[model samples]
Target: MSDEQGFSPRERRASFTLAGIFGMRMLGLFMIMPVFALYGQDLIGFSPLWVGIVIGVYGLTQAILQIPVGWLSDRIGRKPVIYAGLALFALGSVVAALSDSVYGVAIGRVLQGSGAIAGAILALAADITREENRTKAMAIIGVCIGISFAIAMVLGPVLAAFIGLSGVFWTTALLALVGILMVRFMLPEQAHRGQIRDVTAAPELFGRLLKDRQLLRLDFGIMLLHLTLTAVFVAFPLTLLDAGLVAEHHWWLYLPTLLLSFVLIVPFLILGARRNMNKQLFQASILVMMAALLLMAAGQGQLWLLALAMMLYFTAFNFMEASLPAFLSMLAPAGAKGTAMGIYSTSQFFGAFLGGVLGGLLYQQLGGGGVFVLVAVCMAFWFWLATGMTNVSKVRSHILSIGVNIENKDQREQLLQRLMALPGVHEALIIPEEGAAYLKVDGNIFELDQARRLINL
Candidate 1:
């Protein structure tokens, strides 16, 4: 058995496959940011409000479809749904590229968002990796997204300037086409275990996941996080335009800022890991994000002040985006991890939609400052929730499958008691319906050989 918590060697390779799949998909989405707004404004029926609508339309579709798509992936297969989503995304990109009207662009964005590849990709990742090593797989995918976003933000404008907005859409279409090739050629067509959800299991699955307080909190956190992000970007580009900078040159601000934020992100993550300061680090980042929004609201028209505000904003954004999933892994129940993640991701996309609509309204009425104010209020609430979170101590755990002579409650309890008495055993949870046990233990005390012996492996 591997010492790593979330993946075995074969699973690690699969993890990279899913991560690359997700990265390429997100790159298509990110490539639109720098060019869409300015070029879109020139189109018929396009206004700042419509630009925000176009930007968020995909998320609205994505939010609505994520859970169903995930549930579908669990049933039919991962690759099939993934292929369908990518094809839709590419088709939508082509539609948007050919459209001369903003309404058409919005329609295309809705179609693009219908792809909703994230849920399927994540479910596949979970299916491939061992439970102990699942977090690492998710982390790898998350980091790939962050890197892709940072790079794409810089490249979007440069590419847009060279080829124009339609060209950007065509480029996104080409990327999606390439992603389809990768899926068809490179990825293994493994029939993922646990991909299907029984209709009979649906009631219990939803009920248990909904009642989970820890999962709820993480879900809320994700919602708020993405809400703040979408809301900020709704106004951020406009703020740049208002400050005497054209859209193409907006990269001048984003490129260096993203690089610096990336540099800062590594250190905080290292500190959080080494010092067991994950809780503290997580809370601090939320607080910092809140402060940045407030600072943006207060800075208003001053160019230098806005620059500083953005520095804090991206710094906090990068840190929290990386850390939140790690936090969820620590908090999520083992048996329901996939469901928990699915719910969390769904909430994130929903928040993106809400943020866009709300931010657009606020910007239309009160301009950039209003957008900042709205985000600040949202962050303030997040800060309040975060401060109450219990600090968690990391423990080594593995999901173990074993055949047990589970005759009755007493027999199962006795077996659990016996397992608890073993060296290094920390916590043991076994779900009969799921046919698995998750054990937390002292890594050094429980050798794989010993564990196998204890479980009659």
Candidate 2:
């Protein structure tokens, strides 16, 4: 059953199982987003501000714990950390389901965020997949997450109408439990442990990564993007209600917009990747998002206008979400990709949290228009920063195994010098400790067979 590309049964099993589990966990987190602003009114002590807190508190906790949890996985084994995190998530879900007060729900959300297992899951994906195929494996997980978010948006209101908010929380708890079981029985066990260069974060490299300007710009961009997203969701449900679309029928709008956005984003993604037009496309997407925010601000409760804005918003959102990570992968230092990603992810979650709090305050003080204006202003700043970003070359990351016995410094330096001389190798780093040589290479010019023989020798 192996594919022509040579993915073995174990790798495929690990990829699919981990992707499914990640998708399920994300579905639970997102299902409440579309309905929360409106339905939160039913809880005692509910206010726009507290509701925003309940909706966003998870991000704050996730921001606080994501790196530490990933670091924990490195020490305790991937499966063990995953199990514990999922268990915490399930417990939080139950707590949320039983809550009748906004404060209680917010507490549950904090606990849910505390479970943060994204780093651990990614580390495991890297562990099971070979370096050449790692990107594809990661892409599989990314696709699963995007699809889950779309489905969750469509299903959130429908589920809320049928079973109430509590029901949704209970369902999320069940999903987490299912994820726990998947981890235990379905995911392939790894025979090796410790940080994988492309996956787990390195504490020692944090200082260097923090000082990297290009990486910082990308990090800032993600922070603003998620900030805009969380802020919009803080007020968007009310916008729908104001436009006469009842809660139950909201999915009708979400489904069509999501589908259309997916269709629209594909072309841009292709053009960006194939043409090395990511910098241009990335800035363009930000501009499009700003335009969408402006439209929402001016839509005046018209359903048609709001729908159009949503479509535009999702199109830009999907594009940026896909492109940013690609850019990060390309720009990160060879051995510190994991640390770079960890910092990037933390900025993203913190942005979500800040957006929730600030978006809520803005909505409370100045209404929906205020929220849109805030997002638009932030996006405008992002657009300015994005214009200065260095264009990433169209290249792929490849890793070559250095036999464990080749530990001599002189040998490694000699090997690195030889690798650098190879045609199409943009950058090469030989890590003696990891026993691997990481390279950035142009596929069109790189001689894979030649490189393979040299490494094998």
Candidate 3:
């Protein structure tokens, strides 16, 4: 049960568990994208604006609670929080399925967003897998998303055509329930790291994250990326339908386009990782995405042109999706991986919310071209911010959470200073209240035994 990258038995199993959970969750989302807007208009009191807001409401809820949920998972353990989120999401899906009005659907979507367990899921995966193997876990999740998006695009319109929007929501609810079952049966029960339990306040959790410029840039990039994605989907289907492509045949466009993008993305990611070309790949992908958006805006009323633009856009989109997390891993401070990811995930959801709300408004007024133009502008801003980031190699880092028993403030300070001075220690935070210190160190340069010897734990 080892991976190609040489994961141990536990790591391999955990990666598979994460892949399943992420895939199921994304399927619930992707199921809505292709037809939600058009079919949703038939729901009572459905305005174009309300439809867009409903589309994005989940992201808003997810954005607001992602950090808090991750923090809670750190304190209370991952599985319980995850189960709560899943139950909430399932409730939301059922509610949306039965709702007859846009407002009701909106409420359900927000609840669905509440079930977004990204932070908890990632932290749990991090707890189980070693740093060297973390990327593989992330990669498996990434592949699941890619697959889910492709399948969803293919299924969404057909399902909507046959059974309507309510059926889609019902199916989504079923998939979410299946995810809960998988978690119960497949995932291992692991203990939370007892260290770092004292720094539980929200302000303190996010305070350290606010200081890093590079991480902030990545956070901004994720927000804009999702925002652009949501915005484009808002208009793409209608535009295609206007160009004479039926909703049922939409998969004809998505399937090939997604496959092509995947082919392009994998090579680019390998090149970026091996050659340390992440910055270059990131910059180029953003530019490509911008061009694609502008092209879509200008190519309105022409189906072939729109398809070409979509091909270009998704190629860049897939590449960036795979690359950004890798970049975040490189730039984030060593000991606060969960904290750093919390902020990143929160921003992403916020961006998704904004994109849906704003895209819907723009479409109702200025139409498809306007939506594309707005997305392009967002990408331009992200590009400017990312260009200034320092180039970071794909070196692996570790967070060592060790228990401590210091009797006095002076003793704690002395221990903190000594740990910080260690040759490969990049950063260390000692919390006397928690009786533990979080250390970030280069795995290649530091020995785990050295810390054990220092603490004699």
Candidate 4:
């Protein structure tokens, strides 16, 4: 049996394979961000508005389907949902690949969004790993995604330079196919076990989680983060052009900025973690985000200044992108991570869609500088919200199977009491039908074996 000592072999397989799947899928999506408008100009009925729609329509469908699809996965199965989602993504890529009109590509983008597998993919990652090591599994996937996004931003224009827009779509289609193959062959077979509440969304819990001010603030922050990201991608290229940097050489800027951001963020993250400065680090990152935006606005037509601002922007972006979910997970009630994440994902996509709209509108009306300044306003609001939020540091969640021996309500109550009485346990929820106990614990002091013994499993 797998214990907390390390990742079992299956966990290793699941983590790397799932990370590959997510990385490929994200690479496909992000590859278009930096080059879409430039390439869309070649299509029939090309216009700035159409480019924005095509870029963001994917988010629209994704936001609508994320929660529902996650809910569906609980009833059906993870593999099936993942397989179906990949197929839709591939089909969308094909549709876009064959399109000569911007409208057709917009349709393809919408189809791409229909493949909402994030919740399922995350749930699967959680299911395969031991609770103690689950974050490491997730971190693997997160690293893959961050790397993919950076590569895609740098690679997209280079690919378009050689292959054109249609070819990029075909490449994305191939990527989706690769993901499908990995799911079919590379993924480990999940063992039959009780429903994992910590990792799986509970529809019954949505009403309460939705009303939580703390969680809502996090959701709004992610939404703003993505909204600014999409908006920046939409508008910043024009900023580069106005600064005398040609389109092709833009990758030079992105490559260095992204690489430097990744390198610089490590020390910051280490300091944040080691000093137990979650809230401070988080709020400071938000401030950096706002500063980056304002700097972009002020640096109009200044290439060197804009490049510096981008470095700051991405450093904070990368940090917040990874840290927000960790904070949410820490703050989420035992058994509620999945639902919180589901809602968080929905907000993220919706923000993307909104960003596209806003980017297009602002660029047309007030130009790239205006987009950055206005987005900075939103970031300022998020920073304020972050200041008011509470941080749950050094806490980890665990879902333990309490074997089906309880015969009555009194026995269940007694069991829950004992689990709660254990030192360093902050939250406990026992679901008898599921034969599981969900717990949030102070990792420095909590003993998993003690809980295991108390559960008599």
Candidate 5:
């Protein structure tokens, strides 16, 4: 049943099913982005600030609970936590669907975020896939997320026009229910849990990762990226409206811009990955975003200009979204990747919340121009911080099992030194508690069979 890539049928099923479930959940979350500002204004107590709150409150809840929820999954079980999270999401969607006031909708958004199942779902995915195939499984999930975002952007306005905002909430609720059912029936139950050191966050490593300036900078970068993204959406729809684009026709702008931006980002991605220009490409992408924000602030009431700005913004956004994680993976300490990523994810959600609140406050006090200016300022700061980031080496992470009998500290250190002496090995750590050796290696020169034989000894 094994494929050429060594993935068994069950692993393949888990990967695709889990990816679909993640996609469905994200689709529900993103479907509200395009039309929330326009439609939210109709609710009671609908200030610009509340509109931003309603749009972003979910992130606040998500930020607070994602890590704890993952911890809970480890203690009880993955499926149970996933079920509870999805149920919470569905309940929140129903609440939003029934709300007549902005505050009510904000409450629902908070509940929606309380689901916070991302970590748990990823843990479950790790539990099921082989270590070597884990990256491929995660890539499948990543692709699903990208596709869901693209589809949601195009579909949000169209769905809003057809069914109204409440109906969109209802649809989201239904999607969450579907996700719950999939978890119940479709995913294979994990038998024995492996030490997924790379993917599952370890709480003990938080302080170390937080203090590492390199990882902290990357964390801040993700935060600022999502913050700017949310803040822009808070104002962008209104900008389109002022330029005479109707709510129903908004997709006309998003569809073409998104398509063109995807096309435009390919060259940068290629150069960054193929030519080892990631650092240069990363900095340039941020600069592009800053320029786009500046254009947005200055080009009020100009439809064509706004569209061009959006194209620039999305091109950079897409590139950064893809690149940041790769950078994080490369920069994370050998045993602390999960904790580093967990913090990064938390920062991202917090940024979304801050962006919503800041965007709303600025729009209310200083108008849409203020929102753009604020985002531009944040982007500039991000650019400054990014300049100090070191380029990570092109090393890949690998994990090998060590027998539990090798418990002595001297023996462990001796094994670690031997592993590090391998041709392609850059770093190796043998954790006696986990009975595994985590490695960073240049794959081109790393002799896998030789490493395996050494570990078995």
Candidate 6:
């Protein structure tokens, strides 16, 4: 992605620093997911439903506050909002760590979610990176997220075994403080209004984005994915326990399953993407995932079989986590990607919230096996929707900074049409206010020089 000059040193600093910050925050959050179901039962007002509530409560607050916090960053600046969020996060961690009751823990989680800073972090990434290298920067942040999630899976168990859940919460609070230090000392102070349409949500654009069928499909897919994952975890930890895996040794199973799953995921993603078998592999993963869930349910007491099924489920889950965003960026209207993602993320969080409620309910009424069966049935419906999604041919985003804002509405519209007419530019949007043109390009056929000439960049 380098020209005569590659990503500026400052841009490199921004991406990596933000990624580290994001990962630290996510690591703390995810570490809770694996152990909560088991240890939470020790709380004063313990119940399966409250267990699920504590697990999923953060999602509800995160979904509600994420966009609004992003909007706040546009007014008060990124680091300020980021600092405030981290403070809130630390406070919540302390509250949870001190709480003996499940209700108190849930309240603490809600406070933690209120410190939603993902949008602000992304918006800051956009502020610092060049338009052309934006995707690379975003990809770095995304890769960090996946890595954090994997590490947390292992670390959560190890930490829980040594330190009680309160100790884990205290550790998260420390992580939040680390994030604040990184922001204050490591991150550069260069945030502006950051009116980046493709990296920050636009309230006006929400309506059209919501109505787009393709975008909705991706949204639905992400929502269901999170829902099933949260729901499964509600009972999965207990299932392993019932099957003779102690809470302390749970990491033994997770460590191997996660590692083995990673071994297959890269090749699977590469082969699928390269062969244009994305949709086929996507649907196949869904079916395999459904089967895996059922197998786990039926094979509960059989540890080895349960492990195999868990591995299969993770392979599918990891693949989709990578694929869905790519598909969304490909499907999103150029310049509207940010808003689309906001809605998509909200759907994801809301799904997690729903998962907790549903998982707890199903587990209470029908037990662990029923949770798997019912979730599989939900996935069957997801598969039907997947079959109808707009076939996602691979593409990537590029933006040309014309460096001169064109305020004329008619002229901007004409320029948009002209850019769209360019060969291999699958989608184009001209933002007159920003003096840039956002485009989704098929690199194989797109000629950069031709578009550069048209924009006189």
* Residue pairs with backbone overlap in model 4: none
TM-score of decoy 3: 0.87
Top candidate (TM-score): 2
Better of 3 and 4 by lDDT: 4
- C-alpha TM-scores of all predictions: 0.88, 0.97, 0.87, 0.96, 0.96, 0.96
Candidate 2 residue lDDT tens string, 234-349 = 89999889989998899999999999999999899888778888899999999999999999999958999999999999999999998889899888876678888999999998
**Better lDDT candidate (1, 3):** 3
lDDT of each: 0.75, 0.87, 0.79, 0.87, 0.88, 0.87
Per-residue lDDT, model 2, residue 445, is 91
lDDT of 4 by residue, 55-82 (tens): 7778999999998887677778789999
Worst 10 residues of 3 by lDDT: 193-202
- Candidate 2 residue pairs in clash (backbone atoms < 3 Å): none
Judged by whole-model lDDT over C-alpha atoms, candidate 6 comes out at 0.87
- Comparing candidate 2 with candidate 3, which one achieves the higher lDDT? 2
TM-score of 1: 0.88
Candidate 3 local lDDT, residue 135: 56
Q: Give the C-alpha miss distance for residue 51 in model 3, angstroms.
A: 2.6
Residue 182's lDDT within candidate 3 is 81
Residue pairs that clash (backbone atoms under 3 angstroms), model 5: none
Residue pairs that clash (backbone atoms under 3 angstroms), model 6: none
**Candidate 2 local Cα displacement, residue 196, angstroms:** 0.8
Superposed model 2: Cα runs more than 4 Å off: 1-4
Q: Show the colliding residue pairs in model 3.
A: none
Which stretches of candidate 1 lie above 4 Å from their native place? 1-13, 127-134, 196-203, 395-397, 403-417, 422-435, 440-449
Return the lDDT, model 5, position 134: 85
The candidate 6 region of ten consecutive residues with least summed lDDT is 1-10
